[model samples]
Target: MMMMLNNEESEIVKDEKSPCEKPIKLIELSEKPRVYRIPNFLSDEECTHLIESSKNKLRPCNEISSGVHRSGWGLFMKEGEEDHPITQNVFKKMKSFVNLTDSCEVMQVIRYNPGEETSSHFDYFNPLTTNGSMKIGLYGQRVCTILMYLCDVEEGGETSFPEVGVKVKPIKGDAVLFYNCKPNGDVDPLSLHQGDPVIKGTKWIAIKLINQKQQPSNNNNKEGSCAP
Candidate 1:
């Protein structure tokens, strides 16, 4: 009877411990540029929560250089915004999913209405240009980027890589992860990408730029850069 009771207690303890949540599903979209798509990165409720929380914070995007053209509103989250419960949860999942270990820039949420889009641009800073070199010196090269789609659009708003002929539709809760640097730490030119115009409905997205090193003390660096 004593042995049977002990066995029953062990089974009860095992039943009480819940199973761990499953990781996000990753689909390889490219190899050379190291692009991937993560489906169900966020739940519908989580998507809505992020959209509602950041909608009012939107403003004109801060173009890193005059050569780049962007037609959209963006908001870079505050220093402690990551500590917010909603954003913190999302960040935790993203960090784990990508095996991200380096420091990251402040999160930026963007909104695009009909006819709005961003011209093709590279995520890494151009070492040749003065401004780009300065940014790189301060923040280091952007190693990777995680663009999370907060809502689905009715008509357009796909992220397109023209050279690779790859176009990813804006799907709520889906995320696109791409590497900006090669294995040898050199920036890749093939990382060029653009946000296609939204023809029908509005589009909402949140971008997290992962840097090669910890950001500097000054947090005034602008986002988005391109070659002339």
Candidate 2:
């Protein structure tokens, strides 16, 4: 099911969905270079609830560093795994907004504290097997990323695509969706992004969407490696 926000009431405008219907006007950001703001994407109550849930479920900051070689907060979910009800609902809504399928997975939930930032990097285009080798023909291409900001930042901590000179601030209940790969399965250079260091209070949280269906193979193993 898909829902729209009235923008005025700041309430969730629910829309009944047919079995396989997709949401409308889920704009493609890669095709354009602008932030598509959906005001009140989550209601005030929903935002409060999510904050509480995150606080309750907060894992050690070191856990997130283990994955991205950066200091931050993170929680992971397998391709089809649905653990938390709140997270599941958020993921479903995101998928509906982009018309994503089961192949596109909710990879992680991440938060950045003051002074934390990820160096600019492009997502690897291939998936590594359990044995550390690249999947033969099953390399997963990252299509788009849905970064739903869960809290307001006091300063700094904007998601910056330096290559394109674009910066996105953290806004509660607002999502910044962008394409990381071209339709032809090429990684877009402009998608190289970094989390600017938070200068004041903690930057709170965001979601990283990984689309596995469009990933490429580690043919050369030249620049992009799947290892930590």
Candidate 3:
């Protein structure tokens, strides 16, 4: 069960026990979609820094090989890697808002330009495993994903979830927080989302933070990747 209590309303979302069961709310986009958008989630200065840093990391790729042609930016946080300052701060804030038990890792920073959009897909992490041991299943667990919009979009660039019929446009300094997996570690099918094509200007952005364990487990793999 996921609960959010505020002065206006207390939101409690219950996950289905079976992995094959469909999400309860089908018509409403916001109802139990596991997606939350927070406007002005980052400061103006912080947003600018993230954009600059990510721009310097962009990598050219073969567009024709894939369905779309787009560039990518990435930064990984290992045990001793220099962490992105913004990502470190956001991770701390996220811990307070949600219940997390394991150490979190910084995955990648991604940006999409005009005519670029990610196809619908689900974010999945490898099942927890110890050193050369059998994988310890942590199915249906919730994995946190945070996206901070670095640049504003004029038109046609929106994050859309076709399963729930939800579309979120890019707003500078705002962030969208979502859970990639469900309470039982089963990846939520309704959470499948995609980036709409950028018709006007380039879509600049950065993603900060990934999963933190909510309970002690033997799982070791903790890397995350994204496509634009």
Candidate 4:
């Protein structure tokens, strides 16, 4: 369908499904690491709201090699991911895209400036490597990540998957998704990815990680108290 806007248009009705939340058309970008990309995931309004909520609380990102500061978007965005009307609405909407309702990590908002970039890393846990282990999740495993682009970059800032030779550009409202583990719960090394250096303009993004929820253990057993 062609998207056209005219001055005579009074109001544009929103679609039932988000521009990028179509579950049926979930495209697979990689099979080894189970990567996917959904175009136009978030809307322009949603992106702006998230950025506004965390504009003042940005902090310097931690880097191992050089504890010194790097020239990133300088906007380490966060907040409004919880207890906000817009957040609740979007969180509930995301439920329609994947299972495991009680299994999402806090949403993270991040911005990157030209020449800034993050090192390659894996989101899932691995028992073999010290750096690959995840110790602070309330779940079994990190499953999927829904990364949305808040704004566009003029030159660079593509999401690069070096292992699979994939690089996704930063387009406002689009999203990149990928699984960190296989069906049997083993971490996939092919999922390794990193934020490529930004070349020209500022790059804004929001990321949410989904995990396998830890099943509540029923340790206590009780006798039947119900009436027959």
Candidate 5:
């Protein structure tokens, strides 16, 4: 059965005033899964800062599941690091682009070396899988994702939706936002995507995943919720 959005979930998409200093523009990439390309989402300095901070902290990324293949390195910020200036600044800009409430999951900086790529996958939880079910039981569903490109890839490294034939090239300081679930909270299969192999230069991206419910870590007297 498809779950419907409750008042709290509906509030997440309300058109609130942007918290940006500069004008914000959204370039539509796809409609079925509601994908958009945001240019200059991050400044050059912010991108450089994130890359620098993550350089010494990267570790091989974990696979989504036992058999799934995911290639890349990841640097996940510790809990309190959200107060760090670089991340705080990016989070502020992200709000201007998406009407997000409740604290977000920690940002993960990902690095893909030449020839590295993640096989196609869905960002939404697959309830049939044990890991997915466990995750959902704890954090609710991942309803949206905002990916920030920290550097340009000379040759490949495109975020591709094979089912839709949509490809977004990596451009420094740009961001791509996409919905993983419908307004009624059903997982959207059209949101399936992959990180194409980087052929020339490396690819660096920062990921922001928003869940349907607020996480326990951020439940400290915060007024808003992430739920339906």
Candidate 6:
């Protein structure tokens, strides 16, 4: 079980235990639909590999708006047979930790240069009006989002969920996990979040958006199945 070390007004503190040997230090950013942070979720070697492999494939973050609101170089890695061991291991850890049979969407690698910023946005897409593909087995909706930090920032670049008063700084090898929808399957407004502007240094990160799994399970998996 995940150990809740303490509960503060704005955040919950704990050291989350995973299926893997490595223990994670968690900070609960929200309660409803759950938002938590996992320190040291990846190794330095893994972070370096992810950044190097996706560097050449980088492109502007938002194709439509371009560099107006959010400006950055980004790349994506989709699931396939041919994947690096580190990449595959990441998938395995996420899958096992979340207890989800449904696969993840294409992993996104994003880098924010100084002065670049992303406006606040909610992650869950409307089921009826959504245009993008959400299917990957039983996942018709985006349930969980797991973000990993590839590099540390020297100044700004903090992820904020304003409604919950949560702000997480980019820490190398750490991860932030949250749910887009509530237990009732409705999009939670509290899930609204934003990537604060990078002031002085560059920010490197990876995103794994997980869809709902189709398999039936008695496991009551909330965000991540880690016990603190």
Q: How much is the lDDT of residue 188 in candidate 4? A: 83
How far out, in Å, is residue 29 in model 2?
6.7
Please write out the lDDT profile of model 6 over residues 53-157, one tens digit for every residue: 888877777662221356777765534421688887777667545644533455777888898867777666556553424332234467777889899999888
Per-residue lDDT of model 1, residues 18-49, tens digit only:
22155455567777787877777887877887
- Residue 23's lDDT within candidate 3 is 18
Tens-place lDDT per residue, model 4, 14-80, is: 3346533443234566667777666666767888998898767765455212323334433322233
Better of 2 and 4 by TM-score: 4
Candidate with better TM-score, 4 vs 5: 5
Cα lDDT listed for each candidate: 0.74, 0.55, 0.56, 0.64, 0.75, 0.69
- Model 2 stretches with alpha carbons more than 4 Å out: 1-37, 56-69, 78-84, 126-139, 214-228
Candidate 5, clashing residue pairs?
Answer: none
**lDDT rank order:** 5, 1, 6, 4, 3, 2
Q: What is the lDDT, from 0 to 100, of the residue 40 in candidate 4?
A: 64
Candidate 1, run of 10 with poorest lDDT: 8-17
Stretches of model 4 off by over 4 angstroms after superposition: 1-25, 63-81, 129-138, 215-228
Model 2, residue pairs in steric clash:
140-215, 141-214, 141-215
TM-scores of the candidates are 0.82, 0.67, 0.68, 0.74, 0.83, 0.79
Error of 4 at 140 (Å): 2.5
Candidate 5 residue lDDT tens string, 132-198: 7877776778788888899999999999988789899999999888898988888899998889999
Model with the higher lDDT, candidate 2 or 3: 3
How displaced is residue 7 in candidate 4, in Å?
A: 34
- Candidate 3 local distance difference test against the native: 0.56
